[model samples]
Target chain A: MHEMALCEGIIGIVEEEARKRAFAKVNVVCLEIGALSHVAPEALKFCFEAVAARTIARGARLEIVETPGTAWCMDCSRSVEIRQRYEPCPSCGGYHLQVTGGEEMRVRELEVD
Target chain B: MSSERIIQVERDILGKNDRLAADNRARFRADGVLVFNLVSSPGAGKTSLLVRAVAELKDSFPIGVIEGDQQTSNDAERIRATGVAAIQVNTGKGCHLDAAMVGEAYDRLPWLNGGLLFIENVGNLVCPAAFDLGEACKIVVFSTTEGEDKPLKYPDMFAASSLMLINKIDLAPVLDFDLDRTIEYARRVNPGIEVLTVSARTGEGFSAFYAWIRKRWAKLKQAERTAQG
Candidate 1:
């Protein structure tokens, strides 16, 4: 639902640009969901269409990119790849977890000409 | 420029939500709070276990809970009756509690300075596994009544969990529940996951569960103290 609102904003911009360019078709859309983003891919897929309703962006094929969750462990004194929190540091049994990356949910790239 | 061009651009579906989730995770670590995001199916007895655990440990360890649901603050109210502060996040038709929701929910909780925070995610097994709420751990709950094939059926949840709790064991004998097979299947999918058998309703096998918590709590506090000193 949150992502749909965001996608609506994106679609608006895309629509404006497409209309300006006078594009006939949008073949595919490439999307990335950060591991820690907590956004459901399926739900996002459903919401994307809902948000794109009555726009120049209906029935566009969507490509999903899943990014992994990364965290910095104070105990290990190193960066770690993590899918969740409260998990013991894989390298060292430490509880201090600081997520460092893969928390970005954005349109990394798109397919249009 | 009447010609339409196929543009190849890579983007994320969850734009702001992901950024906020990472922000929340960083904030949690910087704050030295261990957050456990609990995911389970409906009637899996997540709240029941939390209530029992809170009731038992409230006197010793300071804790708080954040309950997520599609509607109603009913779970929060139930948690509040245990004498611990509870905050509710209404997803309003959203099936799962995302990191942004957790971050907002935590801001609304009371007395959460260096306490164990349990986030009971909305009652669904699939999407909740896909999202990390910046919790110190993700505890997936399953009840005997839910059947044992849950692990293989929902391998994603098993794969995502650090620990799985098989609750409602008091009724295990009444129902044809097989503990060995359940744990085995779960282990097959997630070899590293720690599975604990418990019954929140009758306190069966709770001693081991409490011991596990005590160990986790001790280690967490020790790390925090060391970082400070």
Candidate 2:
């Protein structure tokens, strides 16, 4: 539901960059979605198509690059891959883990003219 | 004939909101205000707790509230009844309150040189987790009846929050609510999160909650003072 806001932000950036870089149209918008961010890539895609219908990114392909969740375990003093926030640290099986990555929802690249 | 090129447009989808959030943070800091963003599911006693807290603490510290709902001034009215200034933000169809909305609400709020402001976000777990409203810290309110699996089901919300208040603990005896297990689960999702159990009805555990607020508020003021020096 809030994906509409995110899509609008993306469109705002794309339009700004288009004006600055003199791009007439956009072809693809690559996004990096983090596992911990809880943003549904499919929903974002649907929103992108809908919100960008009349913008420069109209019909642009959305390429989602998923990033894995990473957290630092306090007990083990090491970083480990985490699938979910509630999952114990895979290395030391500890709950005292601080998430360090995989919460990104960014537009990494844009294929444009 | 057209040629396509991949432009390295590395930007966050939430960049605009995040930027506005930073601005809000700067404004709060300049004004020496401690702001908290409160989130919870619908019917989780968010407003009840806020009303109670404001009623108790407004005399000690000037308090303001921004109530977010899809449509309604009811929560704001409740907070107003407590004698604290409250602004109701109608998000319309929006599920969450973003920095822009908070920005507008902040402008409408009573100016406090150094005080506490609570933004009660619209009742939803998922969407609010992604939007930053320039709060000093995010607080999640969970009722005892909601079950311990809430952290697992809404990991993002728990992960984003710094504190979790287990509301309606007065009914702990009637319901099979596992206090220890709920804390453990909350810690599993947010390792550094501080959890406190309280019941707005019984006023139980509110002193601890109030103490926590005073501590944080003082700390924020101290930081501002130090920065000014």
Candidate 3:
């Protein structure tokens, strides 16, 4: 799964932060995952544990904050919340909705010792 | 006893890949090379389409290919047989190609200034959608034999692609593929996606594909000239 690669990216970020900030160990890694980002939180957790072994983030707990998917409905001329990309606008029932939010996968913060 | 402290990072998870991709894009722009990333499921005829396209367009334009696969270099071999430069990047347990891999592959190839570089991404619809290799556009190949609901099932890939090529159209009549519904589904996910139907076997609909590439290339050249002036 690509989650493994994403986890590797996370580890790289964490290790870099550790070097820059003079941190000895990481206790928790906070992530902001969007519902429409297509990345599964559970898979991220599984891969994070495997990829974090022996690193500064080894045994670190992952805290994933899920953000809702949001889109701008061109027909309704209003913003709408969507759970998926193919979803139609709730108000006008049109497929002309432009995704406005909830496609992010960011590492927001970290808890370190 | 050590105390735990929170550190604010505020970084995108794919930030490294994105930066690398931006670098690749700058390199491509400097060379005036129009690149397209071709993606699809396994056996969606990505290599076949490239073989046919390169064979016809090589005389008119200098073309190079980067073939990504998990194991074999067979697809690269197929492209090389057409007397074009093609390099194979074997991902080795990786599901998709990343920007770093593509950058390395591009470095290995000969200079292809004022030409086209086609990257045939590993035959996968899911993971490849997330990684950008600095391509001007992404073309997704959906064969008729793969059923129509693929766009619905794999909305991310469909949504990310700029153009969808309905491959294996010659087998559409023999199978129960509904061409209209497939287009509808793809459009539902991505309203701006362009669609074209073709068969690599019969060399059908390739003229339109070449025309599309030429149109984009002309626009790119115009933009480059305007930037210089």
Best by TM-score: 3
Q: For model 2, how does the per-residue alpha-carbon lDDT over B130-161 read when each residue is reduced to its tens digit?
A: 99999999999999989788988998999899
| Position A58, candidate 3: lDDT | 93
Which regions of candidate 2 fall more than 4 Å away from where they truly are?
none
What DockQ does each prediction reach against the true complex?
A: 0.22, 0.85, 0.83
Q: State the weakest 10-residue window (summed lDDT) of model 2 chain A.
A: A83-92
Off by over 4 Å in 3: none
lDDT of 1 at B174: 88
- Candidates in order have lDDT scores of 0.76, 0.92, 0.94
Q: Report the alpha-carbon TM-score of model 2 versus the true structure.
A: 0.98
TM-score of 3: 0.99
Cα displacement (angstroms), candidate 3, residue B65, comes to 0.2
DockQ score for candidate 1: 0.22
Q: What share of the true interface contacts does candidate 2 keep?
A: 0.95
Clash counts for the predictions, in order:
31, 0, 0
Report the candidate with higher TM-score, 1 versus 3: 3
